[model samples]
Target chain A: MTLLLAVKALTQENRDFLAQYDIDVVTPDTVTDDQLSEVVISYAWDNTIGNKILSLPNTKLKWIQAQSAGVDYLPLPLLAKRGITVTNASGLKALPIAQTVLGYLLYFARGLNVYATRTHWEPFTDQYLISELPVLVFGTGRIGQQIAHHIKAFGGKVYGVNTSGRPVAGFDETFPITDYQAGLAKAQVVVDGLPGTKNTENFFDDHFFAQFNQLFLFINIGRGTTLNQSALLEAIDDSRVKYAALDVTTPEPLPHDHPLFERPQILLTQHTSWGENINAGRVGGLFRLFEKNVPSFMKDQTFIQNVVDLNKGY
Target chain B: MTLLLAVKALTQENRDFLAQYDIDVVTPDTVTDDQLSEVVISYAWDNTIGNKILSLPNTKLKWIQAQSAGVDYLPLPLLAKRGITVTNASGLKALPIAQTVLGYLLYFARGLNVYATRTHWEPFTDQYLISELPVLVFGTGRIGQQIAHHIKAFGGKVYGVNTSGRPVAGFDETFPITDYQAGLAKAQVVVDGLPGTKNTENFFDDHFFAQFNQLFLFINIGRGTTLNQSALLEAIDDSRVKYAALDVTTPEPLPHDHPLFERPQILLTQHTSWGENINAGRVGGLFRLFEKNVPSFMKDQTFIQNVVDLNKGY
Candidate 1:
């Protein structure tokens, strides 16, 4: 039987549903090198195993379903060259990721980040509500839209930034990337949800943060390379930025001795914003997308959603 | 002139507004014992000055505008006997308090409570979304309703517990305090927003925590006396309760070495949920309520809002 390597753990329901199709399933760890020729599809791509499967002499890998929204780490050029189709899990994680963005804002707003470390009870007077401050969200994509939605739910004003500066749902105002700085002075909370791309590299540098007329809170849940860490550190040091919550940093698994880890004002969540309720029977959005794509791919090499352009690498 | 003791700091706007009234304003620190007889109204009650003013041989204190909703700390009987009209600052703090309650849930849900203490990058899979959990709010008053509203905005279900269980505004389901256990098994997040009353004293005890069919998150932003500290500790020790956030505790300022302060699972916020946006010249709800009452108070011995019933002690 033709094989499908399910790189991630599958729920019983997924297994039962896939069983109805004419394909044999094998996990990354369980799939053998000899079976590579039979493996026509891969579910939830893994870097090392993906490269190995592609490198096999008689490999028949035709398509890959990526587990994350960003395919920046995937060998997109190589996949494009080999004519291998790639589909991503984009909107699936927007809800949890957006929820985490609000969580980060509250951590700084309610003074939980400071109070979390205390051993004694001391009332802090610096606490504020989300409604009292305005939030500026850069990149009004699925993730940014969800963030804006939750912020609005808290009675907060949301200013969204996108390529065209077109109005998006849940945002009070929208600005293009070139003009986002115009809204900075009025924003007390700034968030970056821009995807990883050549144009976005080092986008939030010193010049970007210097436009804020008042001290503001910063949160970044987007690609790490888009931000300049030194500039953020300087902003925090000068008290221009009160506190920052980062889910993603320049390097994954930031070095234990990294200065970011030493700063009391910066909180590192280690890119785990997307890790919510998936462990329970809630079966993630990725799997649901995979299930929908399975029948189409099996029949005519097409997908129902999230087909990524390998050349753009998103 | 009849004096009004502005115990708390008054904004310039508030001072200007009070100037238009007939009563002359004086702070507790600025007032003399001889002036006690002239002090007819008090804005924002203070424990120390309240006792002193009431004890004075020839004091003329008539009405007091309490800064907090709870009058448990005040000698209600004495105020009642002295014909003191008491008005409270209720509903004003619902937004911030509810926001803080959600912050506590996120602190645990996003694993910030665990990650805040870590120096290294580690991905925790135990994280869950607020939407996945069902929250049970023990009081469906202003604070409780707001909490239910925010939780519902996140797409979570809310079950409210009140005296009659006759259905509050924002709750998906309602249960009387006597039959709250009927819904406890379905609740993954249980909140205490009940007031401090003789019937509610030590309401959350060993039997209360034991009713949960599964591990659940606990949050108490209500009166401390309503929850039993030892019972909560035992719940944490047994792992029956996942984590807890406490804003109010048994003693206002718990001793530095209290066992509750030492638990990694228990988060204490030092009862500062009400301290939000008030500092930013938003002019607290208390001041607005005071302003509305000032005109009526000067015209006649009456209040426009929040007149507390001394016998009920709410």
Candidate 2:
């Protein structure tokens, strides 16, 4: 079978791993129209190259593997129509993203950010004990569950919110999205881990933020489109949201003049949550996950892990 | 029996609690020369008024309960010569300070401080996993042990340095100050939790910092005098120390013009590590420790907790 590798550059180890399979690997520059017709699988770095290959007429692509967890950029309807099985690197980003979430929580709890911006010695009285703060995480997927696990390890009570909220492990309580008002009211910190989808778009608007009675810290490590930026700014102004740490913003490389950059209460992290140590063996994690599922896909066009539902948009 | 209360102001609850005792509680303004002669016990907020009370001739002070953990400012020689029992609020600051240590650790591990200072979106590459970083903490006393406990809870390996190399409950490995080279070499993050003393003063000087072969972050939550400011700045300049987080600096409220203020690699917290949530009931933690020991001291001239050795100077 033939496969297309559209990542930046595959490590020699990854290349060697693919060499073991009886497959012809080709890159976008090298693949001809005839070669594209023979491509049975594609390992995509992003939707840009993936869409180009998909647009080729009479392509024989059977499966598409996304390097990133979020598949919002993918042409889901077209892929579903073409009967292409799509898998994503979901659990691979869990640990690093979870660590990032903890970093934001502890940043606010210890009041380090406030003191970092100060020029004089003034005691900050707004610190909270991480062990006592109640956290409400929006999504119970791999990233959200991992965030909850870390928070729970630190003695923070975690409440998970999902569509069905069918009691996920590592959460003290789980509430369905429709009934999360009580959870939202009690949470001292709210974490947005929801992926970008039709259902999740603008999920945290003014109406949603108005549900909070007490001042709360909001952290968004998920897709930025899932949150309403204007509403978040308003919440910060009204003191409904005490602070915000946004790793992902609506537009990446947010325009230099974006007002969020000027807000001291908001920390924009430039979507660096997935930047784990290069020496920590994380570079191979996604490839390993792909390798594990390859056998299942080869046997019967079935994915053993992280298969995205085209209609659900995750 | 008479007890001099030289704190700024007593909470109504504290005053009511003191009222239950047979001791005559007098504030600094209320206590006169005659009353000084009757002052057999004292709960001091700092050395300013406590030293004055002790200097008075024909004074009857026998025991001093310091509200702060660090008693370096206390006249140790006079207290030791006079045979006055000295107890301090050592363990009281442990939780808050430990939380602060975790704040610094997570801050660097997640690059929040770097992002906080940035005006644009640029990914920071120096992030590390807290669970994988080896931490070396100086002075395994109440504060150091508490810092180790929190680090251990987060799966970080903690190496503690003490005078005797005696095993501490929370540390994975314990080393004496005489043999800390190996620990220093392995440490990715070095935390100074040592108190100010003749032996520890300027202990982390040029030679001590030169032992680090790899890039490391240094955190000072301990007394500022224990660290050599010049050497710390030099280390940061040469890139031997990648980052420095100082809660206490030499001559703090470090003049705004100090060179350390200009370096982006350093984070001066203005000594806010002890800032805990006022609503978290920390106001009573130290007083509660004092109350638990008060009855025993009154009945038998025996101290129950945190009795400081004036000769050692912690």
Candidate 3:
């Protein structure tokens, strides 16, 4: 069987790992259209070249492993119709993202943001204890659960939102997406960890933000499409939202002269939450997931682990 | 007995609490010079009026309760000569100060500082995992122990510096001030929580900073007199110190155009670490200490609890 590697770059360690398997791993540029059809597996990344390969008529392709957790840009309908198996590197970036969330919470609670922008020596008067604040997380996946775990360690109450309201391990309480109003009302801090999908796009619109009664902090480490940026700005301007820490924003690289950069109440990180010494680990996670599923595929054409639901679009 | 209150302002609750006591409480301005000599106790803040009262010929003043943790600015020699019993509000500001230290650590570990000053969209690559970092705290007092406790909770290794190398509760190891070289050698993050004293002033000088072999973060929530600001700037400029989070700096307001303000590597907080909603609790702690010491003074002229050693100047 042949596996096409669609990632722009792969470390030597990862290349060696692929060499150990009984498959011919080749980059998309090296393989012709006829050879692409013969490929039974692919390690995909979000790029023009990768999408072009996926768009091709590859009848024998059994599975495509995504190097990212969010697969919103992928052709879900086409993949579903062709009966292609899909897996994602979901839990690989959990620790770094969770660390960033905790950083935002502490930043507000300790008044670091106020001090950072201060030109004079006036101390901030409005500061609350982190242990007393309640947090509401908008997803219950690996990333959200890890965030909940860290916040709970600091003695904060955590409420989770998910499709089924299934009890996630670290949350104190779980609420279905349909019944998250109570959680939203009491939350002093709200975290958006939902993936970018048609269902999640503009989920945090003006109406969704209006549910919050008190001044609270809003942090989005999820997809930028999940948030309505205009509504967020209005919330901040009207003092409904006291502060915002956005790791993801629309039109990322944010057009350099964007107005968001001038707002002292907002902290924009340019979608770099999953950073630091995790690049090597990310590739290692993808290879491990691929390796685990390969035995099942060889035996009975069955792929397991991190399989994405086509309709849910996660 | 007359007890002069020298604080700048008193809340209604605090005034009511003092009214409940048998002693006549009077502000510094309200107390006459003749009445001042008759006053046997005082609850003092660090101010010109408070210092003037201390410098006056108050032969009858037996005990003074300092409303702040640091009593370095008081006339220690004069107080000792007069044999006046002095008590400070130590441990009262512990929680807030420790929270600020954790904020600094998380700020650097999660790359919030880099994002705060960025004009472009380049992500920081030098981020570190907080749990893997080693922290060295210079003081075994209430504030230092609390900082150690929070850092340890996050899975970081904590080492303490003290006069006797005595084992502190939350620290994994202890090193005396005389033998802190080994501790400094291995510290990835260093916190100065040492009280301001003649021995400690300018302790973090150029020679002291040169001992560090790797990149490290230096946080000063301790007295500003303990740090040589010029040397700190030099270290940062030379890359010996990767970053600095100074909640306290010499010449308190730090002069608007001080070079430290221009350095992005240093986060100047203008001595506001013990801020937030902890003021009410601070007054309560002082009252509790004063109330406990009063009974002993009334019975046998003995005062205990947070008694400052004049020779030590803390």
Candidate 4:
């Protein structure tokens, strides 16, 4: 089987690991206008050119192995029409996202805000801090599950949101989206780990936010498109949202004069998630595919880790 | 059951909560040298005068409850002589510390420093972010434990240090001070959450830092005395340490021109970890004692959530 692993850079150590197999490692940029028979795609696919790349090899391409946990960007129609099997690296990103979410949460919960607040001469320096606030996580995917586990360790009561009412580990309670209103109703901190899709878009709009019982600590690390920025801004303006941390913003590289940047309550970090250290794993996976002569998910098009449904655009 | 909640401002609602019992609420200023015998004492006692509150009711006090988790300031000899029961609010600060540690970890792991090194812009942004760094957490107390737990949640290998060699929940490995040599040997991120005792002070001196594998993030959410600032400066100068975030500083208000302030590696934020909100929970602990004769940590004495060995000065 001819296996193709696409990534930015592969380390010598990783290259040696893949040398054991018969695989051709290529850069994402290398997969140009011409499509290959079997290609394992990493996260570096440029949105504008990604679909075109997938369409090039219609009959020959067997599968597309994705390196990201989020499947939203995958060229679903091309893969579907060509019958290209797809899989993803969903589990890997969860640990990192969970860590990132906690960073934002703690930054907010710890009152890091006061660090920048003005005080006379100095502030009241105390030894003991307050209790952990209850967290209501709005997603039970890998990211949510991992986040729940960490929150539980902090002695926090975690309520998770999922499509089904099935119980999830690490969460005190898991309710369906039907009960999402109640879950958010009691949440002191609301985390939107929900993958962005047409259905979930504008999920935290004006009406949705109005349902929050108290001033909410809203964090969006999932996808920017899932948010209704205007509504989120309104929540901030209305005082219903105490703090909003957005790791992903629509049309990123938010204008230097963006209104959100000026809002003291909002913390804007670039969409720095997922793009972290891709070369190592992507390269390693490629090496493994080539040497093992493994019928990679890229060739089979049946087994994928993070597959985005084209119809839903997630 | 008279409780004296010592804080700058204690609320009527909290006062009423304690008043349900027979509590006589008093602020630090209201407690004249006389009415000491009739009440129990509690204070936002991390300040310089935390222990002096004990002297007001030097003889009559049953318990010296502290609104702080660390009783480093409690006069050990005095409390010991009077047999004044001292208990603290240890776990309360866990949430914020956990949050702070994770924030720095993200900042450290993701190379947010590169951006921070220059302005918050790019060309620098193209640098890669690595997430798999090992973190060494000193002081396996509640706050430290929480920090370790969250670090692991982010795919970190957590190593810890504490007085006892007991196993902490999230640490992959822990070493008692007797094994300090072994523990410091493997840490990249050294967090100081240790109590500031004579022995603890300057614990992170040259010799201590020389053992680290490579210090990337040096955080002080605990006592500043835990580190020898001079040794730390040298470590930074020689490139042994990368970043230092001091939430608590020695001789705080650190003289604007202190070596640490201007250093690109160190981020100073006064002593503001527990400064999020001075809500009722903080001052209420002391009031709880005064109102109902309940100690902050009586049920779990030996390792009361916030137990401190005053003789050790932390």
Query: Against the hidden reference, what TM-scores do the models get?
Result: 0.93, 0.94, 0.91, 0.76
Kindly list the per-residue Cα lDDT of model 1 for residues B54-107, writing each as its tens digit. 888788889888888777888889999989989887787888899999998888
Native contacts recovered, each model? 0.83, 0.60, 0.50, 0.23
The per-model DockQ list reads 0.78, 0.60, 0.51, 0.26
Candidate 2 residue spans exceeding 4 A from truth? A2-8, B2-21
In order, the first chain's TM-score in every candidate is 0.93, 0.94, 0.92, 0.82
lDDT of 4 by residue, A19-50 (tens): 55545566655655444434544323455554
TM-score, prediction 1: 0.93
Worst 10 residues of 4 chain B by lDDT: B119-128
Please give, for residues B1-90, the per-residue lDDT of candidate 3 as tens digits: 446554545566666655565566667657777776666777766557656666676457777788778888778788898888788888
Ranking by DockQ: 1, 2, 3, 4
Please state how well chain A of candidate 2 matches the true chain A, as a TM-score: 0.94
- For lDDT, the strongest prediction is 1
Model 1 backbone overlap count? 0
lDDT tens readout by residue for model 4, B211-298: 5555777888878778888888888888788777777777776775677766766666676665545566555644553334343333
- Measured on C-alpha atoms, candidate 4 has an lDDT of 0.63
Interface RMSD of each: 1.0, 1.9, 2.1, 5.0
Query: What is the Cα-based lDDT of residue A147 in candidate 2?
Result: 88
What's model 2's TM-score? Answer: 0.94
In candidate 1 the C-alpha lDDT for residue A104 amounts to: 87
The positional error of residue A248 in candidate 4, measured at the CA in angstroms, is 1.8
